[model samples]
Target: MATEKWVFMVTAQTPTNIAVIKYWGKRDEVRILPVNDSISVTLDPDHLCTVTTVAVSPAFDRDRMWLNGKEISLSGSRYQNCLREIRGRAGDVEDMEKGIKIRKKDWEKLNLHIASHNNFPTAAGLASSAAGFACLVFSLAKLMNVDEDPSHLSAIARQGSGSACRSLFGGFVKWTMGSKEDGSDSVAVQLADEKHWDDLVIIIAVVSSRQKETSSTSGMRESVETSLLLQHRAKEVVPKRILQMEEAIKNRDFASFTQLTCTDSNQFHAVCLDTSPPIFYMNDTSHRIISLVEKWNRSEGTPQVKF
Candidate 1:
């Protein structure tokens, strides 16, 4: 063991993702294999993201973490999964200036101190978990010298949060629901880089709600348990939509893109309604917003009109 006590760290930023084609249910919870393909837009990292700094030092006694300057538990399975995966792939590190050196074997015994900060408010209900977990995996990979590409690391991030896999790449992303039982192909891929469709302006309405009566996770599970429509959707509907959405993104077809996005979102919520105790994610306010958009579109008499 080299007698270097100096600390080494890596900082990285990862953006949140919003699924245009949504990831609703999982086939394998532990492996996080999706039942259907999902497409998402990697939001601007500057707007909503997590910035994480991961440091490894022999001085540390155990793995510790802090989020938004507040010390938090690292006992969560998500965090542990990411930490364990990255540590297993850790490589030797040498810093001539700081006179610090870390061997591949040393990483197994060393504890890491991780600190993360999110740009947006956690209360916003925007997928902060996606950004947080992506940032964690990304920063640790940098520190560990992981050789896998972003898509490979994305498979690891998927275990943290279903949506997080999309954030491993920039611009539009797609999480392919592969057929393999081992989930080797269940990874995110870039649909198009950010520059491909710069004209796209996404607006997020911070709707007021007194906590969703049914969370998307539980609601989807209920749908899978009871709804025949959901089964049909996973088996029949999504595969075609995934192909169309890919084409829309590739050709910058806003008309096809908007239609598919709106329809898919509605179908997902509709599946919730098919459950025994229906989930009402969209309130009167949500309905009113939809009506407003509908009326405006009808007045325009063109499907391709933009907001």
Candidate 2:
């Protein structure tokens, strides 16, 4: 066994993303595969993100984690799945200076200690999990010396959070919902880098920082089970909308992009309402804010701000 005194770790920061074409349901729940293709714009890491530190040591007996300085269980399938996938791809790591050497096969026997902190509120409908899980997978991959590309690592992150797949990229990203049962082909791809749409400004409205009563995972499951609209969306609406969104993004058509973004966001909430026992992710304040934006856009004949 290697010396228990030495600790080898890697730290990484990943940004949260906001979906333009929102992902509302899942076809494979255990894999966290989405029901439809969704596109998103990655946010600035300096503003909102998750910073994760993954440490490996011989002294540790088991995998453990802490979120926001609070110890959290790693027994959850999301965490376990990411760990398993990354470990499977683990490569031999050696550091002569630190006098540490880990063979590829040694990863399975080793334990990890992870500490993650998110700048934004978690589970408050701000897509914090997107950043949190992405950072978790990314930092661990670095520590394990996994040689996979970002797209490959994104597939692993998707198992942690569906939107997390998109966070692996810089600016515009699309998560393709693959038809395969194994979800091997389902992964996120970068559409455009941050410099592609440098003129665009993103502003997030803070309605409530409180935790949501219904988590996105549970709500998505409910919608998939009971909402016919969600099925229709997965089959019909999003496919065409995705193409349009792609064009709008490519052409830098601000008007078209804003239209698609606002439309998809509203329809996503509508799917929630269509579900049995209807989920209400937005509040009265949220509705009023949307209405105000619409009114202003109408008066100006162009979008000043898109919700």
Candidate 3:
């Protein structure tokens, strides 16, 4: 009897997320754990998402991947970690008609071919990593029949990027900085769905998103090493701000939301200045945009910038 070659694949889409309460640092670098809790709004999946198709075939010899239709090296630690974790949880798969039988043990030996695409501009300041990892996990979960819920799967995505955990859900999400040393509890939870506050309109204007000279990772690391304000902001300010932000979200108070978001952004910038070399995430153009908004608000005599 002659055996036939088999190809089985699964595809999934996931949205990118923007943090209102930004994730500035990490307590556990290897686990991609954060120092302080962060909250984000999951953008519309239709507007921005990564579509990943994961396939396993008898003809494949080793694991291979493509990003945005171009072959990208999976040699990075992030890719390797995600692949290893997902593969460990692989379950049984079968196709009765094709007589294709993939036992639980076969997953270890069978190599994978993955192709991913992003709808939005990757070079833009948007959070591509968040969507990319979420899709990677989502697609793999379906392919392997992993029984874990979105929150459990978020923990897996977190290993790929610190901000990615929040993209597992829609609407407002909070990435709780779990206390466990093993980072088992560090996962995202939904605070409010998109329809919870229908009247609010959110606008994001990118003044000039030229690739930041210092990556957020290196910039935060420098801040942690030198900035005196960093200690107080993390230890004192963020704890109170988080509670207030939660209350604002719960009550749908746009006034409170505006104030807290603006203040926290300024405070973060101040901490950047307090760094020895001074890392500036926001440029002069950012200030100009803020000034224009402030002038417009004054002219209207009321907060017209709703959303």
Candidate 4:
């Protein structure tokens, strides 16, 4: 390592995603593999997104991170997994003007400083971790010049947070629950571009901005362990829904899309409640909104508006 006090940094912005076909449980928790294939639509980066900046410097003693300007521990396995995967693929980087050169071998020893912030609320069932982790890995890959495609990088992001793999793409994306032990085949694939269905509108209601009492990871674990609905949904329900959802998106079939999205969402919440001791992700206000949407749909004789 050089004695020069040179700092190299990279910043990236990644948007969160709304899972139409929800991913509620993990088959392999260690690798962050979901039990069922899920589909999501990435949101606009102009709002409700995460921006992360990663820096590498010889002066730093170890890998450290700050989330929303507050220092956070990187001791978690999720962070370690992402760091290990990206570092292993680090490439040589050189900047002539800065008189700095970092070989691929130096990445193992070089400490990184990461700072991330989310425009939307964190852990309020908003998939903030998805955007956060995707931004983290995406920014780091740019910093280290890791030679990998978005699909490959999505696999690394999946280890950080399951839904994060979907944020790697723009529009509609599918996270296939690969039939592999190592999770190499479990990757996010783009179903369509952002402009694929430009006419559709998405309305987000923020009933609560505070973090939920139960984390998604813990809730999923609890559900997988106890909820019979989760097992059935993962094995029977989700597979069919995923296929229908894909066709809906492809054909821009609003009726089918609305039906699939709303039902899958309801089923997901039901699975949450089916867990031992139960988990409630939606409050009264959320229920009211859903009820109102349902009433309007029932009166209109079709899904004129979907929640």
Candidate 5:
């Protein structure tokens, strides 16, 4: 394997997801197990997604990655965890044309060169990490000939970013907060395929392109430490909301869908405000947009938008 000059590569693209029933807190930080069940809608991959190419070569000295054409560190525990997990599941590979044969055990010794690019702006309050991690895991899994399903691969992606698990599936997906301590059962399941709700239209308005002052990881950590509303939301409010949202999705009840979506988003913001020092994710412009949408809904006698 060391003498081979050929590089085995695979490229994959994954879409980002918007959580309708948000996952804000974690029960296990290291494993990235969320405190409550959350549901998300996977966006169109053609519109917002990450394209990652993973190449494994015997000549490469160490694992490396480039994000958006800039070299980035792979020393982070998240990246290392995903890499290790995927490597552990790798299967034997043979490329007859390239005259390359890689045994399952050989994956551990081989180094990887990964290059990822996002079509959308990263760190601008969008779910870029979700798409990025999902793309990384998906591409490496393909390159290594991992036999695991998307659900199994999603568990690895979850360690990178909790919301990343939901990005592995299309359409309406749910991440069930599994009760297992090992977090093996915590995986994303598809409720419906992308074509199920073709009538639905989603519009995203970006208010700012700057990186957030408080990342979701740090913000959620603060909420877990300080916000009582976060605790209650996880324990009491989200449970009922999850069931209702699931039902609304199953039945395609647009009215109930709009109601639940708006309420859950408001509650998420409320929890943020309830945090110590009150993390502000939405600015004045965001507030104005919400107000305008609410007024429009009132005038129309039905909900028009879910912000």
Candidate 6:
């Protein structure tokens, strides 16, 4: 191949998101489509984010990836799906300085080497997969010159992680659980920019950095199968809460925001408890923190912080 010695690369950083209205159950597991709309706040990338570098070379023999300096397999369906979706949208690229040209059709034949690093700890309930997948899609899109906008690319990211779609944008984002079967319309949209509610300070207290025993995916599946509350929350509670949360975010109503956030979080855990095995995500420390926050809010006659 003429480009044997040439390597083309792109680097991107994406911030993690905290779901105020959590996405607990999935309607379509293969596509990672949620049963209801969920809203989240994208944290500042400087503090919590993932940095990914994607490189394509004709000299490489196969697609490979490394996470946090350790080599990892790209054989998983999530990785394969993201890669296929991105490559399908790739456009022609010509770098005059490097004397390298990659045609749109050539993307399928090329192999990629991806290295990703997260600023925060993984599996610590930190949404590392959200930032990691968002970064992977964003960086690959840049390298391959994908013409899609952020919202369009978010659909691709959604296949990697349900919450990942929200990380594509800054500030408040909502993942619309579109009615489409293909999930083409299920994408993330910005509710409000970062500056709109910049005054709301966020403080994260890490009670335990240990990985949770239950993953959100498996836990959600269990909830869907065993918990009747999951159905009620997804069908009735979430729709109303989503509308209220959207309004709160739009109007910058901290009181309403805090109320809705706390209520939704409580319901999410309630469903967890309703599960057959009863998944316990929050430890004693977590409960104490929630109690303290609730007491403080009551004493102040308004929400001072959201748990």
lDDT value for model 5 = 0.92
Over 4 Å off in model 4, which ranges? none
At residue 120, give the lDDT of candidate 5.
Answer: 86
**Candidate 5, residues 114-205: lDDT per residue as tens digits?**
99999988988789999999999999899989998888988999999999999999999999999999999999999998998878888888
Compose the digit string of candidate 1's lDDT tens values, residues 1-307.
4665768899999999888887888898778888899999988888878999999888899999999999999897878888888888888888888887788998999899999998776634578888988999999999988889999999889888878889999899999988899888999999799999998888777676255566656776787788888888999999999999999999999889999999998988888788868777677777888888888889888664332
Candidate 2 structure quality by residue, lDDT tens digits, 73-177? 999899989999999999999998888999999999989999999988888888999999999999999999999999999999999999999999999999999
Residue 16 Cα positional deviation in candidate 5, in Å, after optimal superposition? 0.3
TM-score of decoy 1: 0.93
Candidate 4, residues 186-276: lDDT per residue as tens digits?
9999999999998888888999999999999899999999999999988888889888999999999999999999899899899999999
Model 5, C-alpha of 55: deviation from truth (Å)? 0.4
Per-residue error for 136 in candidate 2, Å, reads: 0.5
Any runs in candidate 1 off by more than 4 Å, and if so which? Answer: 209-216, 303-307
Rate residue 101 of model 6 by lDDT: 88
Q: Which residue runs does candidate 6 get wrong by more than 4 Å? A: none
lDDT against the true structure, each candidate? 0.85, 0.92, 0.83, 0.93, 0.92, 0.93
What is candidate 3's lDDT per residue for 49-79, written digit by digit as tens?
8888999887888889998888988888998
Instruction: List candidate 3 segments past 4 Å from native.
Output: 1-3, 96-99
Count of steric clashes across candidates, in order:
0, 0, 1, 0, 0, 0
Candidate 3 lDDT score at position 62: 83
TM-score of 5: 0.98
Q: How big is the positional error of residue 299 in model 2, measured in Å on the Cα after superposition?
A: 2.2
Please say which candidate is ahead in TM-score: 1 or 4. 4
Show where candidate 5 strays beyond 4 Å: none
What are the RMSDs of all candidates, in order?
2.0, 1.0, 2.3, 1.1, 0.9, 1.1
TM-score of each: 0.93, 0.98, 0.92, 0.98, 0.98, 0.98
